[model samples]
Target: MLDASGYTVISGPVGSYLAERLAAAIASRNRWNGCVWLRRPQRNLRSLDAALAEACAKRWRADTHPTDDPRRRLERALLGSPEGAVVVVEVTDLTTAIGRLMTGLRPLASDRGVRLVVVAEGLRLPVVRFAPDALVAPAALGGVDGLAARVGLLASAPVAARRLTRLAERRPAVATDLLDAAAVWPHDVLLGALAGRTRTLERVTAALLDLCTPAQRSALETCATTGYWHPQLDTGVVRAADLRPWLVPLEESWSWVRPIWLAPLRRALARRGPSPVVARPAAAGPGSPDDRRLRPPDDRRSRSTGDQGSRSSEDQGSRWTGRGVVEVRLFGGFEVRVDGVVVDFPGRRGRSVLRFLLTRPDRRCPRDQLLEEFWPDVDGRAARNRLQVAVSGLRSALRSATNDHVIEYASGEYRIAPAVRVRTDVEEFEEALGAARSAGRPDVALSAYHQAIDLYRGDFAADVPYESWTLLPRESLRLRYLDALDAAGRIALRTGRIDDCVVTAHRVLEVDPCREDAHRLLMRCYARQGRPHQARRQYELCRRLLAATLSVEPAPETTALYRSIRPR
Candidate 1:
């Protein structure tokens, strides 16, 4: 139900069967006043603005303001439309571009009489927080009364259909897969697959598990063994959205793994018996933590407080003794390991404290600053207590795998132990970039640049992009990465590596669609390949992105390049 805001957000997996059915229902109801459906296909490279323009073409037939952007154009068109006119937007993914677009449209849509329906995958916090009314449509695939009819099993074997539905964990996607298998195989073969007598079910289950991080898998395994998750477990590290169409929420903090997955998890656990190997962390997107052994620190100098830099007890020749460095990965995801084993923190807050301290150039931070940064919403005394608890928890977690003196407190300041050797991806990334810049030879510089680029798995601490302290640093690292890519592209172009130039240029556009220079780079690459038509298409995409999103034309340089490449 929508409140005074006239904004309704449907939360679920974007392409799921239930979400699509609900969207169709909404469109059917709003057909009287006119419903504009805006959707982008998976393979479509067109921007969201292009989708919107196409959807509202009939409504926007009348002249719009000359200076209006996509938002304003839609607003003008909506304001003049009949009452109850609704715009149903199908969001493919929640990128930065979509976030900005939604924020601007929310208020304008609220003030107007028309209703705005946003069908988005995962939970969009901004949409939920800003909207006066929001609804999360359930994704459960319960009830088997009409299930057999839908899958063509009711007349032939109703009982088997009900049993199959239950075995599929009542998940529409899983049930559909089972039905597809049934169609291809004989009854005995299908039964064998379901019973795990064949490898078919195992293969399918393994594919789904592959998407999860080590932590998520561990959590799921625990849930499979026990009925519920431990209350103190940091489930925030498990992105529910990422587990979608398979894992569903049983309650606010607990998740219900589909029945299809339960037997496989239990069997795998039984096979391992004791000391099961923890899978390394997968290379996930922002806020994703993956496990991999990090390279040791290049420098062996101890971080001592005094000018003389006396080595502390813990640092006394540990590097030579062959104890591995405490590898802290802050880029892409937040992960720490000692001797190649992943360290598990007590909670997300403890991990956050560790990340905050690592970002400090001096490796020390004032106690007051930490409390203010991490626990600002709480009262002073409570916030201070929380900070201490977080720090203590962080220290304990690290101590389990390394020296007890990994963290130290002195004179109202908290810092990493001066004696401990640490290596971080962020440092490695910067060092490689520095090496690239200082290299005298083009080949040397190009190699350094590629090394730096590879180190940047994703944005810094990408898993927690919205945190207050990470905002500036995240943007800073992203710009540096873009610059490195630009440099690499230019060098590759000069060296006659047309393919490398094209690849780097495409990577830049993926991160920031409005990167006009990257578009020009692609234009040049395509023209070099003697593909003027493709070059013109690139220019048109650039112009449309600028006009629709920024309400501006491409720069003069871009136009001139396009003119030269045009089939004149």
Candidate 2:
């Protein structure tokens, strides 16, 4: 067995926070006998060392070779022990440092004796000298999204982490001293007090005022006053060519002042009144998606065609609005309606592939997962080709109903995007049932469970009941429905709605007649109403179901429940 390979290179945006986090992970690895961190002797490097100590819980001694030549000293450091060791080197300037170090480190890096890791900023690492196999690159942190993530990485508190994300999402690309303050404490820095005039705050305020024209400053003040900035809504700003430079667009209609300076700008503006937005000489930056875009896929779903009932029918008006409101009914049967028109999945493979994606529509499903599930016997190349053809077929099948939003491929994976409001009955049912479980009030749970049962028109993939692949999913849906019905009945009984309890219990029996719990529930409901005959009848039905379906008599609990309820 192989012990190790050439050193790995983890490349990302340059920050002590990221490097420290990586060091912590490397230190935790069991195989490494030793670890060393190399960097230039400077104030920022010292800060990194301090962060490393807190992050990985081990202080690394600064062992910069004081030898006559730095090259020899750096070479000796690179060539750690012949055995196993992990080496992390920080680079401020990638071009000059990387090639020179790699030239000196060629033997050690290639020997595989020690694992070499290079940590540097994205800007510094223009071109890497290390082998392509060794690079582990994560995307550069961008704007509020990136900042929010950075806050979470450094903060331990859950509430603080959430606040950090909220702040970053809401104020994209709007850098401020207060925003930078989040990384300072890492744990709810927003909750901290601002006492005397801070230099960083003043500097940030000055920078914003300098960046914007007099009119733009006034427009910002008006925005701060209103608590929202609509560039189009402001007539003067709309006509100005410098609006882009004055404020970067965060969403369709909304824009925020560059580099934030919100608190400072607000205070500055209150001194006078609203100002016009004048043209700035500098070019505008690219627009970013609104914070609303960060909403979950399920949340992104349009509520226009809100809730659909189980076995409930509605005449959804037939209109092929390119909006692609795809309604998938999987329980009881399979039906995919585009807008309001029924679309046929003319092939088994297409239907199966679609079903898997529908179950987990929020993310992309890789080709391998789909191939292994459906085409287990086929080789990789053939399976991939088949998948491509199948995807095309699906698009054609759903062209009228779903149009462009049906099945999309990207990076060798496929997904059903939420661009088309997708409402699958099974998902809706499970969602309702989940809501019931979390619901505090019995009535809430009762309503949820009832709706879940109603939405389940038939078994999941009931159209392909005998198909081998369909068995597990079909059985799963059936069992969950029975469980939901059982909970609904129990809630009904607890709420003194005995008639509703009896009805729910009967629904459970229709799904799984041999379920003794449903039988006992029905008997209890009848007995509570003083219908001894009905209770006795429920006991006989349970006995017959047990004998016929499972060849077993009632359990001790069932017999005792019958005795308690029947003519007693």
Candidate 3:
């Protein structure tokens, strides 16, 4: 289905069946040494290399020696495989490190006569830089006939096929969904009005919209309601949606690839009322104080779980502009605020120094260790001097914002002041996760879990992407976020929030394809919605993933669930 050699980047739409289709095609070929699919690349190159090595070992069942370096192990595995063997690597979350890793492994792979194919999504910098020989867009379903045939709607239900083909907008995932929804209809009424049915249309539309970002959703809603793209919008806005494979250019404007989205989009917009214009937070410069704070440190009791104790609009924003609390935002980016004012670090090292201390368990680090971590290249004496300067600058920056001593130095160590009331998004997210798991009521648990999921904007200390020390904490927080999402998804499934349940299950699978429980949730969700075929398909996916990654079959429970839902 793809080139036998070199890299082929597949810019498939997110939350679509494109990857699964491609995987199936590759499996049919059955002529590979080993195909390693990394659904989400770990933090560093070594971890990714280890995954590749592990996959190779499992495939060959050879003694690749776990103690050997990953690259060495992979080299041995590739050489030992039969000549002309094909090795494909399909990575969903492509990072710059993964791109470089593939580039480094390409020559060795080629020398061993093992073909390499790298599949990725989006036009992100890493994808562009990989410079694959061929870039394939797997968005279009080859027009109406192709989509109809693929979804098994062409001959089985012609009228339904035509309507659904248009509704799918040439997107395979949407076509699959429409097919599943239509499966519930009686054969005689398969041609009945589908677009006019608000319930069915709303269900599919909501699922599709959930795939889009808030910005993309707003742009699409404007195009749907106004009959033209927003004049004020730039090409970036249109291009943004274009990247997703669901929107197409229509004349000078962008329109939904699937026309059926219009009514549902309008209905959703009506419920949302006016879309509020939120200003982007200004980029923090050296020593620049942030104008707004995240939340008050002592406002811990006013959680989002209940309406009575929930924070008001003012409190949610920079409401408390006093000297009692310090807020540290460390999810997407790093920022520190004292008394509701953003504190600017004196320099990069100063910021890193503060981040290093803040991330530690005790919020303290020995001076010597700090010097080793932050100034390892410098001579010991000079590194010590640099650490002192960095700490001094950080302390000076904090003092400028408030009278409180946010950083303290004592006993050859520097730490965040015990007296300073510090609150961070990471802490809050974990708190909410704990609350959700321990909550007495389902509703409370659901609310808390959702809140925790929302609080995780991105990975921990995102600005310091390549820092070795950040990886553990970043992965830890990410796993926690996924846990919260899984918990919330189960709740939504129980409460009959099918759209939310489906969305969460897909999200979990995206980050961790081997998650059988998430796959089971999706299967159960489809079964409850009367889409038995989709439920069975989800089981097949689960089976495939488990077999490929772990060389194991589906768990007994998963198999039982599939059997129950299968056509008897």
Candidate 4:
């Protein structure tokens, strides 16, 4: 038994018995309304209908709507219902149900006085746009005793009502509300708030309503809406309007056109403001090649002299020497070699720093970007100091090994010099694949691709966890490399290079067993090489792997390949 005031989500497998018990309890109370959200109505239709009927008989209005029809049902239930009505939305399949609820119910719940109960069997409450007022996992209901006791309390007097409210607030259900509010607020504010320190939709709404604005709240909202402003433009001095023109275009394009656009804007604004103009060097006559360049040479010479003296003062600053290859082997272990010698780079942090640089060699890596990628857990001065130490160690290591300073620091950025020979196995693999596409001889290209395939010992730093920066490129390169092998294998088989084709196809399968192309290539290679049994066996293995991993049968192409290889 439950009261008219509370909302619930009856989550679990359709015939898990928990749904029936929840229905019976709600029925006894005669105050709750039930709505079952299921993926496949045909499977759970009978049981759910039975539960709905039982709840309805007890004076609780009940309905069943498939997750696909959530928007219609939720709108009908919320807007159409009498005041203080309790709606229980049963989500039989968590994924489908969550998707529907997040897309539909969240906005409705936010605007109206409605509470959502997500019934997912084993899942934590589905993350919705607008947080649910309460969350009740069937397991947390703690069997029949806890469920009955809570229901009985809900049916009791006003004193019991206060206790029930307190208990429900303590439930994990409250987290749903908090997270939901957090999810929708920022975006809502960004779209809603026209002025003030509104960075996110959440902050705008919270500011409009005059809720708690934590020290970082405005800053976070600014970063979310306007992009990260340079620390030089301290929030104390700078306002949101100062950022909007550039921010609007950048936000529209979804480009990080921050600090980049900000610099020019700041200079323009400063010039327009009450800032004193500094005098420039006197111009040379018309014949002089840009007087600015001529005046700068004398100043540049003096600065160069100063830099030379400073360089002499420092101990062994000339480490990155000569135009030699910076070989980065990023399979098995993360290794960096200048030419062929394995230089000892100081600190694990420094090694990681170098690895990041080597991955995108000859490109400018900003200090902030590096800090965010590498020392994400640390913040402010600590992260900066760590980066400085790592950069110093990298410079020292390169200088000691090669006797040439190849890593150039300029304009608050670090880059591997263009002249330096940077050779990564990944890069080499890409190069070989490029050659294969253009080479006049298919066999020559196949050989080069095979060599490239051999270089990929394993997943790029397989030991490393999935990082936001590395995962995308790593997976992309890995997939591309595998595809190249598949293509090369097909070419090899077509050219009657049976042994080479079989070897390369097998290698492809080792990395990705369900690669349909690899399976087809291998089958064709085996059959052409007079190995029908092996071809059939390969098909069976692929079929099993596909079924196990993806829960789907092999495509017609795969079965066709097997049929072609069957013993006649």
Candidate 5:
């Protein structure tokens, strides 16, 4: 196993037998501090509470304190265990509870240094199926890296192991096929086929497809098309399918049945080409505002439960979140709005903490990481206490809009769970910048750039300009804003929008007073506006800025542009 073996998938012809043995083999080794085997209960535990009671059974409980959330209890359990301790969760019972399960597990992989080894019959897991925040590492068991450990596990089931080994000995390719299929399909199916006990790939896939009802087929198509399934999309089909032993809930809302066999099924379903399982939204008509789907999302993210909380409305973009409607505008100034109404957070440091978390790409900042980032000058104990206080103040203020748990704590990290619809101008600005760059057509690109420019009213977190947390994104957005200005200026000039060009170039200089490109664009816009002296004055400003800033003459291009615009 890799050093940080957060997740390992074991699958092959005898994958089920091997999965159990793999756990057993690890159990045999006395090197670990502790181990928890997560098998389906010997007795029935139908509800999640029941299942957790069974899964957790006497493993984690503080002598002085008791916690109810299974996720928290598991974290406490793992924290109490020493390094190299293992938890083997049976996929069969836990597939439907993927989100709750991953919410507990994913944070631990990073914060606790724990390794979760999942033994499944195939590549399908609840994590892959849902496409939630994926774990850091994903390794296949039949693959080369962990081969020795898996080889020893084969002895647990002599008959299946011996038969598979014999088949591999004769064909040799059987071993290769077994690994390949194990990556995507069930190990048993691959083993049966390679052992000449089943049909060809096409028929094997078709047989699997035949087993799926239309609803199941549709669900497979959706996850395949979208790359992950979200349970919030909880249709009758998806919900029913989720309960089955075959469905594995991955990280967040990802889904997979036999991802390896999906390609052939997709091909068979659409022999013509890439036919999306769901119909795409029609393009906006001429004179229409650019659709958020077609552009970077400047608007608030959709709160659609129908699509499983994934923001992307199309084939591959976005995760729809629940109800964080408290929008924080970080552009011109800092303003927290709940449902479009302005509200102030309780204390001074509360805004800083919220700003830091809002700026983080993943939104999960460990308590220690936050201390290092925001309070490097303070003592560790003091900083941690300060953070706790600030968290309380922030949550207190946000409690009216969100619950007291809007700022959530788990596994040594605190993250925002601010209702369902939370939006930040900074996040939207970055998204717009990306959309502008990725837009295919020049017009589309120009439109996106213009939209991005409009969204960026001022520098990022202008109120907290000097904060360490604000500097990186602030500068990044500043550079991107400059680029958008330059691009938009050119587009305006080319399209005969001279006034817009002048405004855009002037705005560029407002941000970076020495930008020769902006100076050149202004010179042209001024010359085109028949303001020759103004054009010449723009060149003089560029020359002086170069001399003052860099102590050197303006570039040859600037001088050449100045000469071109001389009053004549």
Candidate 6:
């Protein structure tokens, strides 16, 4: 049912056993790709949690976006799932669940084919009006007597009850077969194959002798003989014996037969080749941790493939120049230096505008888009005027250092000109990270990563909430930076640079205290560094923060790390 549809909702009290039963039923049905939405925070590590954990360990991808409200989480889950993917949501109470039902009904109703399953303690008809195609009452699981009693509660007449009982008894195997058939090929092929496999001389003769019109079975025999498995094939009567000869000519002419047979062989041959492996650099010393935490995210690293001309010293318009170049450094803080003398860029908005353009130099940003981002709450006219002023100030600032126009306004768009030598700390950080990722020496990679961290001043484009355009990239870069730090810290610990790992992990915790991996890594680092007390402290802090914020305990892996570090 879930596979045929795209969504399902399961609601019941916490620890009510319904979630596990439903999950087991879904898994037994083999809907491997369906996602189960975990709503109740208190129910973690219970039967349902264990079931989900097992499911994920079996190669299913799972992502958790912790939220306080079940309703909001449900909305986000629905929005996030890829189109046509099954969604199983667990709700704790009938009242709250029914509220969600009403809100979600419109969207679910629009997709008439999607399935909705609601589970609760009792099979009492829900006041919320959703007529499910099938209902399973848990009380029926007791025995034949219990099942009879539950069946009696339904309004179905005695005749219908007996019919349903018989059908229910026969349905499981048929459902299994149908699932198996669905797995093998398209529905039409399954139908054709089943028909062909069942056709016999006795059945054919019986139909012919009975003077009955040829059934779909005859057409299946014709198709099997003709090798025409397509749904568009003519449905005409043909003897089963005649099919083999007709199929011979058609099989040879079919275009897809060769490729279909060759695919697995081709894949097998491809797998025989040696897998390519990337060699990473050695880990850094203890100091490396601070460096990794301090660095900007690696994605914003510079990708300039060519050398740019430096700011020229000959022109009086040049701000300051040496070696015919002006170097703009973006690490830690934004700075443009000509011959080592810093050129001052005026105004906050001007600086922001310049930084925004320089971040993705040469990429055009439409005027309206820029205005909306940089000053979203301001009126259109006021925003445009502010943008104009910012741009003018930025241009004037650039003019102080060089004859070249750094920022260009053209074709109803704004962009930094290619010739401007813009050196960004974020770009440098990313480049270092890339080098580290590719380095043959872990120490070298660690050093590069450290340098990258030194370049980060604060959050990317900090104090720019009005700029909605930058929020996604900003958050993405922030997470990447944190991940890279964790990776570097792990490498440091592995290489016996315990002090460095400790510092690095601590830096990460400063930015995000809830990072369990960083906490665990730091604990290990402290243990190796002979600071058992510090390790214990880190564990305690993690326990406190996780409990307070998420209302959950640290994962077993984290607990194990702490136990390993505790003094004997």
Q: Which candidate should be chosen as best, given TM-score against the real structure?
A: 1
- Runs in model 3 with CA error above 4 Å? 1-310, 313-320, 339-347, 396-404
| Residue-wise C-alpha lDDT for candidate 5, range 464-522, written one tens digit per residue | 87786678878888899899888877877897877667767767776788888998998
lDDT of 2 by residue, 463-546 (tens): 777757678888888889889878977877887877667757766765677899998998888888988876876788688768
User: What tens-digit string does per-residue lDDT give for candidate 4 at 1-568?
Assistant: 2321234445542123344345544443233543332322222433443433343234334253445243454454455444334445444344433434443555664455444444444334434332344344422332223322433323434443343244333332322222223333343332233222322223333343333122223322324323333332222333333333233221222222233233443343333321111111222332111111111100101011111111221211222233566767675457676755667776877877676777774656888889999888997799999898888888888787687676887888878887787767677667767876787877556655644554565677664645566787778878987887777777767777676577567667767878888888878887887878767867876887799899998899989879877684
Give the winner by lDDT: 3
Runs with alpha carbons beyond 4 Å of true place in candidate 6: 1-334, 375-385, 463-466, 531-533
| Stretches of model 2 off by over 4 angstroms after superposition | 1-322, 361-363, 378-385, 402-405, 566-568
How high is the CA lDDT of each candidate model?
0.60, 0.55, 0.61, 0.50, 0.56, 0.48
Q: Model 5: runs farther than 4 Å from truth?
A: 1-323
Worst 10 residues of 5 by lDDT: 295-304
Question: How high is the lDDT of residue 509 in model 4?
Answer: 71
TM-score of candidate 2 relative to the true fold: 0.42
Please report how far candidate 3 places residue 249 from its true position, in Å. Answer: 16
User: Over the stretch 14-33, how does candidate 6's per-residue lDDT look in tens digits?
Assistant: 12345545665565333435
**Least well predicted 10-residue stretch by lDDT in candidate 2:** 289-298
Instruction: Give candidate 4 regions above 4 Å deviation.
Output: 1-324
Task: Name the lDDT of candidate 5.
Answer: 0.56
Better of 2 and 4 by lDDT: 2
Model 1 lDDT-worst window of ten: 299-308
Q: Which ten residues in a row have the lowest lDDT in candidate 3?
A: 291-300
Residue 16's lDDT in candidate 1: 39
| Backbone clashes, candidate 6 | 16
